[model samples]
Target: MNRTGAALLLVAGAGVIAVTLALWGQPLVSASGGIRLWVNSIWSPETSQQVADWYSVSHLVQGMLLALLLRALPLRRPDTVLLWSAFAIGVGWELAEHTDFVLDRFRATTLYQGYLGDTVLNAVMDYVFMLAGVALARALPVGASLALVAVLELASSLIARDSLTLSTLQVVAPQQAVADWQDAIRPARP
Candidate 1:
């Protein structure tokens, strides 16, 4: 699709996400009625309320992976398809992530015990971040893109004790050993 068409598609997707979140009783911003550019702690109540957090890295990786997957398909217009597919995937994930089933699953199996759904702003920004990842994947060589993914996964895991890879593994197949290791780094609750 043309640049204008792609931009319109993304804007429409964001609108849908925001409306859905509001319908689901998600606030437009934090309870404090403020918007933050970033929240560093994955354990913080504000993590998913803010515009960006460590899991934002995971969304970026999702975009890259989606782009790669679409490109691998035999579509005649891979670039155009990538944009549509990424939008669909990002919107679908945001909608699904807020559901009780997914939220409860994450709470039970992952480090996100305090997990609530993202605020509208954060969810929209996540879609934007995912688009950024698509851009990154298109700009770099395949090997470089893979290298960057490795670096992002390793760094996020090392810094936060969680990453996309770890989160996926925990959700798909919970392990007491890994949970213990992740919980070891968590600050004690008051």
Candidate 2:
């Protein structure tokens, strides 16, 4: 993508993030310090719903992967292709997260025992985060983009509570050890 296209994506991303914050109107979760650009805790019971938490990283990684995957396809205007894909995937996931079945699935799992659905503001922010990732992938070198994807995946899991890869693994396979580990971090309440 050209500089102009990348700049536009950045502007659009910022606008969406701003709109999300405006819509939130109030902080959903109050951390000890306050809303931050990034929080290290994965499931603090305090900062989970804050502006930037562990699961927030998942959205960005998802966008990077989706953008990369879509770009791989033989399509002209790859950025446009990515834009539509992000819309469909982002909206679909937002709707899915609110569904009873998906919420139950999350509740049954290790990572999200207190698995209430996301707030509308958080949901919107999540979509915008993905857009940021898409823009990053388009603007950065392939190696740098891949490196970022790697760093995000690792940091989220190691420094926080969950990650895209771990979430997908637990969802698809439901491993005992992973479940045990997650339980160790924040045990499920009765």
Candidate 3:
């Protein structure tokens, strides 16, 4: 399929996913009942309710990594397949993320003590951000993409005291020391 066709398909897929989420009783917006472009505090109740948050950075990185992975593989038309694959993965994660199993895991292990799943808007925007990442990876040099990933990772870590890497480690391993450090370093919630 052509690029525009593939993009439209992904948008349709996102629409279906959004409707499914609504049916599953997920809110289209935060409990605050507002539509925000960005929410600065990751610790706030509005964290995953808005269009963008710190975790959105991780999603963007996810796209870059997925695109790079597909490019490395001996697959035909990787560019054509990249968007669909990334959208499927993102939707899958968003669906699973709202499940009791994943939510419990995050609450038990990560700094997301009060963690709830993303709002529909946030979830959909995440896919968009990932697509942006895919475009970015295709546009920039390999070294540049990697450098951007490094910068984003470091910036998220320093700013939030938790990042995609740390969150993944916490879920997969759950080191007590790291959890304690995260709790200690977490800024006072508003």
Off by over 4 Å in 1: none
Clash count list over all predictions = 0, 1, 0
Better of 1 and 3 by lDDT: 1
State each model's CA lDDT, in order: 0.87, 0.70, 0.81
- Model 2, span 1-190: residue lDDT tens: 5667655655555455445544645344453545556656666664445566677789899988887887678997876767767766776676666677877887777667776665444666677787778878878887888999999898877766468998988877788887777667663556
Measured over all alpha carbons after superposition, the RMSD of each candidate to the real structure, in angstroms, is: 1.3, 4.4, 1.8
On lDDT, the stronger of 1 and 2 is: 1
lDDT of 3 by residue, 80-130 (tens): 677678777877887888889998998887577878788889888887787
| Candidate numbers, best TM-score first, in rank order | 1, 3, 2
Better of 2 and 3 by lDDT: 3
- Candidate 1 residue lDDT tens string, 118-186: 889999999999988998998888888888999999999888878889999998889889888888877
Error of 3 at 111 (Å): 1.3
- Model 3 misplacement above 4 A: 187-190
